[model samples]
Target: MFELKSVSKTFQLPNKDSLQVLQNLSLTVNKGEIFGLIGLSGAGKSTALRTFNLLEKPDSGHVYFQNKEIHGGQIDQLRLVRQKIGMIFQHFNLISNKTVEENVALPLKIAGWKPALIQARVLECLKLVHLENKNHSYPNQLSGGQKQRVAIARAIANHPDLLLADEPTSALDPITKIEILDCLTEINKKFGLTIIIATHEMNIVRRLCDRVAILDQGQIQEILPVARGEIHPQTKLGKMLLEIT
Candidate 1:
């Protein structure tokens, strides 16, 4: 459902030199698949993910959603396309001033959903993330896991076809991490959401993703399937991940 073709991104420094972040990065994500993008810090994993939402524009090449190119020139088209894609960050970007319900409903409200529809959708989304009873709570009152749940609820409230999760489990305790992973798994299964998760945590990828890609220095080093009986014979990242577990 999503494709990146020879996409590259660079940042200009004050000294006039450029830091190339993404170099001819290309990949495809299909419907009903959890594609894991794993790499060390500064490996361009986050930059590559940002290109999907045009949060970071590619310096060259194209990003296609369902075969349609997404770029800066097509703001209206990009907006409509982005409605089908949702994103969640490592830090739960919740508004401290808004109640949990309000936070989740904000996206729908911005999309111009009617009051009744937004209310119903917000409740439904909270229920999916198992946070239905906390609607009246504020972000300050929630735990790390609860905050992440609220973020997930907000991301999915629009019924997006694709969900981009950038280190969703990074800040949680081990037990909480498992719970959040389970919640994400449930969403993928129940809603057929295509998930592209950028994370350093291999355990989450092993448990959740159908296929995994290891990125290093703005390039994909390997792509492997996640199955107990399947062995990735050639990829260093896959072998390393398997040996660690």
Candidate 2:
């Protein structure tokens, strides 16, 4: 469903030097699969995730989503394709003043859905995240876990074909982290949503991802299949990250 080919990215530092974040990175994520990008800090995992939807334009290489080249498309055409992709960040990124339902409905409203349809979809999404009763509550009124759930609801509000979550559970407690991961897993299975998650948590990938790509020094070191069971990382960095987990 998604492909990245020889993707290379470099950012010009404030001092005028350039720092390469990705180098000849290539990956393929199948439809209806939960794919994980495993890496440590500054490993370019987040950068790689952003490239999936063209949020980060690689200095070189191509990104294809459903056979359509993302960077090659017209502005309007690219925008249309983006509507089918949803992203939720480490921070909840909720509107502080908007009610949970309003936040969840924002994407649909922007998509120009009828009021009745928006209301229906909002309620449906809230229920999926078990936030139905928190509809009238604002972000500040909800707990961290609740806020993340609302964010999840908002992200999937438009029934996106793909979901990209960056360090989704990194900020929550262990219990809350489990809850959010469970919700993501449920979302994947229930909607056949193809999910690509960028995280350093080995447990998270083990609990959720069908396959994982371990990255180090801006390059993909190995791609491990998680379906058979618990995987021991073969690469040095992968094993190092796993040791801390």
Best candidate (score: TM-score)? 2
Candidate 2 structure quality by residue, lDDT tens digits, 180-221 = 999999999998999999999998988999999998879999
After superposition, which runs of candidate 1 have C-alpha atoms over 4 Å from their true positions?
A: 14-16, 228-233, 241-245
Cα RMSD to native, each candidate?
Answer: 1.7, 1.2
Highest lDDT model number: 2
For candidate 1, give the lDDT.
Answer: 0.88
| Cα lDDT listed for each candidate | 0.88, 0.91
Find the number of clashing residue pairs for candidate 1.
Answer: 0
TM-score on alpha carbons, each prediction: 0.94, 0.97
- Clash-forming residue pairs, model 1: none
